[model samples]
Target: MVIIKYYKGVESNLYNYKAMQAEIKNIDLELNELKNEYNGCSSISYEEKAAPTNKFNSSVENEMIDRRLKPEQLKIKKHKLEVQLQKIDNALETLSEDEMHLVELRYFKKLQFKVIAERIDRNEMYCVCLKSKIIKKLIPLIFLLDK
Candidate 1:
């Protein structure tokens, strides 16, 4: 089925748009924090490189026994989060004003539908319906954009 696209300012609400933009900022902040943590652990200065490469196993094992297991796991987790953050940012960019607003309120802000409805002046049922439809549209867009 073909989806209809709305023109700029067409059935779009300003409050929703602003809400989304703000939520995007929060996601960005969170993404940056994750990246910073990842960098801290993965840094390689010349001094660090002075050690034998094989030292990694001993150092890592020591850290693990001291309750710092999974250095590699942290890297993988950071990578996954980066991918997820990119998808969310790209999806936010592609959304129409209306859909973007709905997604921001529901997912980004982590608001329940009833609360979103109250804020946006819509019925909760309608907000939930719109949210589901917007999510459906965004899912593949995110996947394609990430690829």
Candidate 2:
């Protein structure tokens, strides 16, 4: 496939795949905490006021609303992360075993090119070229950058 345009931040997104997975785990923990915080609490409450006015709300009330919405926000974030993860996963699935290993060594393990070359039994130049090709291949798969 031909790449018409090099999408900005594709390299960074590829490099940060492992970090993104870790973030998803953290989000899960946060969502659990939020859920536990509101467990057994009344979902409905009644408040009496002198007049039925909705013009303004107290800071406390606003904070409470924000807190209540926290889990939904977190869920949205988690879903985004999951989608990115799925894209990366699908891209990885398309790679050959050697390509996958190169990606794991270079990106997931954060290895230097020299080290990766040594590990993969290839010359440094070959490793560099292969890495470039892999990134190009993945850009289309991961980002759907092909037109």
Candidate 3:
């Protein structure tokens, strides 16, 4: 099997991680908004107890039903986000020191391979080889696929 690994681009990956986190936060905010809307509807119905009509109760019931459904959906989303977070953490852990430094220089510092190699007192080709290996290591760790 041709194991095509796209390694050494840690900046984009880290940015992707941050984007995922932002998405998770956005999801949380959406869930909270839904809950708050439900609560407002529910409380208003209760507050209007003296009004004699089935309309208020029915509206409140609809709001409650929505509240019930939303939480279940949010729970599923939260679980998926948690799994993604775990994968990112695992990828970070699996990196060797050299591999990690290479990634840091390449991604965080925005250094070219030649510059990175010069700073580290190595050839650019050496960085390329190491980066390829690092990418291979990261792929399985991030995807949780069979190696």
Q: Which model scores highest in lDDT? A: 2
**lDDT for 80 (candidate 2):** 97
Task: Arrange candidates by TM-score, descending.
Answer: 2, 3, 1
Prediction 3 TM-score vs. true: 0.59
Query: What TM-score do all the candidates reach, one by one?
Result: 0.47, 0.77, 0.59
- In model 1, the Cα lDDT at residue 107 comes to 59
- Prediction 2 TM-score vs. true: 0.77
**Regions of model 2 farther than 4 Å from truth:** 1-8, 38-60
Residues 1-147, candidate 3: write the lDDT tens digits: 335433433335654665677878888898888766634443454555666776545666767777888778877988887787787678978787777788778765678899999988999999988877777777767766678
- Candidate 3 regions with alpha-carbon error over 4 angstroms: 5-15, 39-68, 105-123
lDDT by residue for model 1 (28-145), tens: 6665565455322333445455556655644334444533334345545656656655655776687788777787677557788889999889999999788666655665665553
Give the candidate number with the greatest TM-score. 2
- Cα lDDT tens digits, model 2, 1-147, are 134345334567778888998999999999888666643433333453446677555445655786788888998999999998898898889889998898889878899999999998999999888878887787878777653
Q: Flag the better candidate by TM-score, 1 or 2.
A: 2
